[model samples]
Target: MDVVNLNQFCIIFPCYVMMILTILWIWRIVNWVWIRPLQVEKSLRAQGFNGNPYRLLHGDSRDMAAMIRDAQSRPIHLSQRNILPRVLPLHHHIIANYGKASFIWIGPEARVLIMDPLLIQEILNKNNVFKKPTPNPLAKYLVCGLSGYEDLKWAKHRKIINPAFYLEKLKNMVGDMSTSCSAMAKKWEDLFEGRMVIEIDVQPYLWELSCEIISKTAFGSRNEEGKKILKLQGEQAELTRQVLQSVYVPGWRYVPTRRNRRLKEINSQVCTLLRSIINQRQKAIELGHVKGDDLLGILLKSNEKEIEEDESNCGMSIDEVIEECKTFYFSGQESTSNLLSWTMFLLSVNKEWQDRAREEVFRVFGNDPLHFDGLNRLKTLTMIIYEVLRLYPPGVIFNRIIYEDTKLGHMTLPAGVHLLLPIILLHYDRELWGDDAHDFKPERFSQGIAKATNNQLAYFPFSWGPRTCIGNNFSLLEVKVTLATILRRFSFQLSASYTHAPAYVVTLQPQFGVQLMLTRL
Candidate 1:
């Protein structure tokens, strides 16, 4: 009887332990899916915020996705300047129904859309209190360098990478940028094939031009390898886009799905290539076989200097350096290509602006090679670029998450609430930009950004304050060079086949590509 009782106790005790664990897990899930979200909703509603009531674990995700699909189904006219509705359908709808000061649900998370420039200024300035939200785990596989870092780590990477993008350092890269642009121009001319005018899709050419420029400037002599890395990154960007479009399940990235497997494979290949390049560059630098002049060289040199100063707590590891290189490729390529594409499209449609820009380009350079000083002197071109950025900014929205209860303006936001600073909405806000906000008026920026924004933090194409994009100046310079070079050779108009559809995939891009009829000057 004693032996039988002991055996029964062992089996029964194990069952009891399993039951307790299962109950705890279920309770945690219930709290996350129901209780916590309701509590957050209540807090937000009490604070005068209006949005759709929370519904289970999905929140407003289904509606948001539906709205986006509906919006993308129809193409807006080329003459339509109010692209806010098309680019961000759900946000536009929410703001229209719930007013500007409102909240929306992204999964169980409550993301409040703050369009007030003053509050945005505070959010951008107070980086410590309102921090960058954790990015989608899968995005890290594509590119996560300085942009993905937070607090002290961000500072360290920014400090080490600063010298690489300094005005002086970028000046050294101008020649490479000019050469790449000239190459693209030659390719276009060859495609003309003795024809006076040719209708070509400039989007692909612009992408290629941007990619080549980044490869050469970022990697110097190892540019061929850089090109290979960028090609892989482009694939990774597309895959990541697909993943982001779908509902993201926690731990889904680890599941060995076909897409997941491909992403990992591409990531592995990119890392292998970058690691090889970095190792080779380091070896060459140590042997004094190469002068560290390009962006990578400057970054490596800066990292070494940082380590020498504070050996224990400074400098980036090899993996971190590789990430930054990936960032250089992605940001440099994506931003410039999009800016140029839109500039071409806008210039094509608005012939007066195109002529004015071309006139300015001719006056500055006069059929001569582009120089840094001359590019800066192209004031009209600068105004046009600024306007394009205002209309079709690369990043439409900026996100921040608070880790603790924080006071923003008059309201105290609870911890875990996310903040969204919609750059596009503020840009198109009639209150800040007046009634003609949506119109493509390059003249608005002629008096400079401060004068245009009335000294408020209204216009931030590359964002504003302490955490502004590090590549702002670099991107502008590349755009100027490429645009000036192209403007010098050809006068372009939107081709009849061109469709005016701007889609937001990773960044704002011409959904059907920017096709133009190029007439040789």
Candidate 2:
């Protein structure tokens, strides 16, 4: 009977093990699907906030997607809703339903929408709590350098990379910026066939300008390799767009699909290009052939200085430096180009404003070529550029992820949730800018941005606070200089063929291109 009991116990042991495993699995499912979300919902409810009930599996993704489709299919307008049906359909609805501060769910994720100027200011101020969210995984495939990293690694990279964009360092690059602008100005000059209305898509011209500036600044005299990197980066961006538009399966990054395979190939090519350029620069330095204040040289010197000052403040690892160089190459190219393109588009539309800007450009710059000091005096031009950025910001919205439960204004935010501040929506809020918010009025900003938004944190073209764009000064100077040069030689107007569809791809861009009729002034 004892032997029988021992055999029965052995049989029951397997059953008991299965039962315990099943119980653990159920607990995980319950915690993830119901219990955790309910706790978050309760916290939000206590704050007097309400949103759609979180579904077990889908959450609000399906509803959000449907609403976006419907809203986008309506019509494209100045409002944010018509911008990207697939991305922000809930944008219009949230504004309509919850006034300024509304909440929405995106696949078990709660994104609190803050468009109120005061709240936007508060969130942007608390950078410790409201840090920028990582882009979707596939974005790393496209811009896989500094913009992708997070946590301590990101902080370290940001520190090492900060010196390259100092105003004095950037001022030294003005000649290179002017040289690129001159090249584009020559292109426009060639197009002027004696009152000949040449239909030109300015995006490529602006893209070339940006590429050349990055090439000269990042690579200095050795821009041949930088041009190749630019080509591969463009290809990578295109491939990235294709990947982003596809259906995302879990672990898609590791899968061996054609898109994935092509992405890997392009990424390899881009990396090889960057590595070769870095090696060439290093070799030049070793052989004592390097010169001037090009970005790479300055960065190397800065890194070494930091190391000498403090062991703990050591320079970036070789791999880290390479990644940062790639980031500078890509970001520098994309941002300046986008700003130039949009500024030209807006100027084309508002010819009165364009004429006023041209007048200011001439008033400050005169017959003399653009100088650092002269660039500063173009106050009216600066106001016009500021206004353009306000309406057509490069990114529609920026997101901040909460790492812990924190008090935001009168509300308590949950961990793992996102605080989304829609810059475009905030820029267009009638209450913030009066009834003419949607109108293109540069004069409104003539008194400077402080008076424009009543000193609210409403006008941060390069963002605000400690993490504001490091290159804001550089970018603004480039924009002002480039626009002054272009206006000095040629007059432009929106062509009949032009379409006004703005789309977001790394930066907000004209989808159909900004077609303009160029005439020699």
Count of backbone collisions within predicted model 2 = 1
The worst-scoring run of ten residues by lDDT in candidate 1 lies at: 241-250
Clash pairs detected, candidate 1: none
Give the TM-score (vs. native) of candidate 1: 0.96
Task: Candidate 1: count the clashes.
Answer: 0
Worst 10 residues of 2 by lDDT: 78-87
lDDT of 2 at 22: 100
TM-score for every candidate vs. truth? 0.96, 0.88
Per residue, candidate 1 scores C-alpha lDDT tens digits across 1-521 of 59999999999999999999999989988987788889988988888899989888778888877877787788898678899888988889999999998998877888999988889999999888888888788877988899888999999999999999888988988899999899999988888878999999999999888888887888765667766877888788888876765557788888998999999999899989989988888898899998978888899999999999996965899999999998998888998899999999999989999999999988888988889998889999999999999999998888999988888899988889999999999999999999999999999998999999999988898978788999999999999999999999999999999988888877888889999999987
Error of 1 at 159 (Å): 1.0
For each predicted model, how many residue pairs clash, with residues at least 3 apart or on different chains?
0, 1
Q: lDDT values of the candidates?
A: 0.89, 0.75
